[model samples]
Target: MIKVFYIEDNNGQYISADGSKRWTRLTGQALYDFLQTERGKKTHFFVDTDDNGVAIGVEIRNTELASNLKGDKNHSDYLKQVRDESGYITVSFDYFETEDGTSTGDEVIPNDEDSIENDVLRQFDLETLRRALDTLTEDEHALICALFLQDKPMTEREYAKSIGVPRTTLEHRKKLVLQKLIKFF
Candidate 1:
């Protein structure tokens, strides 16, 4: 079972399942209410404590939000990392096999001739895209990379802050760059 503990004063305390502990009494209701209001594709878990402040039970609700929260949709390693980082109850959903015989999560299939052909086509497309991008000025290219190519792209506000520009100014520049790139395409 994935455990969630409450952190107070740099200490981790187990969540009670019986609602008999202090933190359970004070924070449990508010937490549960928040969970209800925010319920969606992820699993919602409530930790309950017993009289001596030991965690007794963790209540988990099933939701598709689990997939999004975990990023991988079928693995719990990220969930464990989240638990370690946040000190919150970590919950994982049951992975059931689909009747439609789709991938059972993260399994890699060997490439076939069709897959190789697709990869070649994709590479060609990327090459064309690169050629098109070559028409952009250096600043425009940088702007495009900031807006799109980074592994974790920054928000407009973040990009503006990094560049010491106002958000509106950044937005305007972004618009102009996009227009130029579109014309090139």
Candidate 2:
């Protein structure tokens, strides 16, 4: 028997943004592990079965599912190899602290007033930002992380060309990402 896993809240209440039920099937366990560990959430996994009560696949709902929906050609073929070599697929989810150590409300403020520029940047909670970011598509997250979360940043044109998109499209995407981040603030 095969099982399908769908992610629900820690309490197992699964609902979409419109207050409707959402469901989908998970193909590969590697894909499942990528989402659970990378996103750091408690997922409610549901096993799927045939009419004969034989396990089949897992049901899932999230941006991760959407991103991998068509299944990349290489990745899909690779998963097939993995499934052939292994007898079973396994996946699990867990929750962990977003930050290391404890944060005290009494951290010292910098005396350099120039260091603080955007008011929105100053007021964001780390956990809230993380949650908001998780709402973004995988591509958007990857682009933003590549640009802002690196020591050396890629030029907009260079990054755009690398992704096979127009420079203007990249700029527009960056703007949208900034707007989403601002909403969290």
Candidate 3:
């Protein structure tokens, strides 16, 4: 006996239970896999028989039936190679944090002054860096802030262009500022 699969009133389309996409794709792998699933097993398939009403073969609903509507006439069409559509295919990946993703006692970055008390050396170095930064000229200070301290710091080229300065000139000034800062260390 031969069986052909199809939904009663669908436009030859059977979507996945998630409704994110149509499960009746032309590729056989997905359809084959779906058939192996519980939902796929529950799908309705019709009998396709010879003129004598004798059984020939079985056609799965989400696979052969969908392929038929796609104009794939050859019975061996599923045997042909299919281009991978994994990029466009959407699969839900909302898994909870597994043991592999968990962090193991790493130092967390401090968010405020009180949090910095956890490390005395870091606190001292930060105070020294603040004093060094205070000695910068207004122009140099603005450049430093734009390049390094902003929440979304600008690139050197971008900051230079914004201040109407050549990149090389900005680099030279930055170098001089670093040299000045080194003296304060």
Candidate 4:
């Protein structure tokens, strides 16, 4: 069975259902509401679906806003251009298939050692890494230099005080920096 769940921005109402036919109508309404909210904005949605083409749930985003939040100008600019020219954007759902057509019923976890090694290898690309580092604000650079470069991973509170940014802001900046750095791998 496919399950569908969505929230309508206009009225802050949520709708959910199981089975293909029952969910179809709600899905249409949700899409219409999504488009309405996305007027003059670029958007994307992540849909979780079952093997039988039934959607399990959906998560939506303003693509431009998300890119800006990540401090990623390239993506934000592209999405902005697309939104300016197009009234609506179509999104495709991704489906993951099981080898034996059965749910594993277990969480997929990464090997920690391998992940660490990969992260280290990704840091070895000097030019790209330097460029990513350059994108950071001065305060962000100082904090990162103190942590990874200088071998000190300060707590969020300590890092924020040292960098002269709010703890939350510093946390967000660190996440964005790490995401950009990961692309080099």
Clashes of 1: 10
Off by over 4 Å in 4: 1-128
- In order of TM-score, best first, we have 1, 3, 2, 4
lDDT tens digits, residues 68-145, model 3?
Answer: 644543433333323243334322333433578664333343367655565787878889989999999999888888
Per-residue alpha-carbon lDDT of model 4 for 1-185, expressed as tens digits?
54464432444344345322222224555555655765413444444446787874434456665445445546665786898799765333223336765644333445888899988777777667788888888866876886678655778788788767898997888888778678765
lDDT of the candidates, in the order given? 0.60, 0.64, 0.64, 0.61
TM-score of 3: 0.38
Could you tell me the lDDT of residue 130 within candidate 4?
A: 89
Q: How many angstroms is residue 60 displaced in model 1 relative to the true structure, after the best TM-score fit?
A: 19
Candidate with maximal TM-score: 1
lDDT of 2: 0.64
Taking the candidates one at a time, how many backbone clashes does each contain? Answer: 10, 12, 4, 0
- Point out where model 2 deviates above 4 Å: 1-124
Tell how far residue 80 is off in model 4, in angstroms.
Answer: 61
Q: List the residue pairs that clash in candidate 1.
A: 4-89, 16-48, 16-49, 17-48, 17-49, 41-64, 41-65, 41-66, 42-65, 42-66
The sequence of per-residue lDDT tens digits that candidate 1 reaches over residues 1-185 is 22233322123254346644433321455444634553312434334445666653333334454335435533555666787899976333224346775645433334587788999999998887798789888877877898799998889899889889999999999998778767644
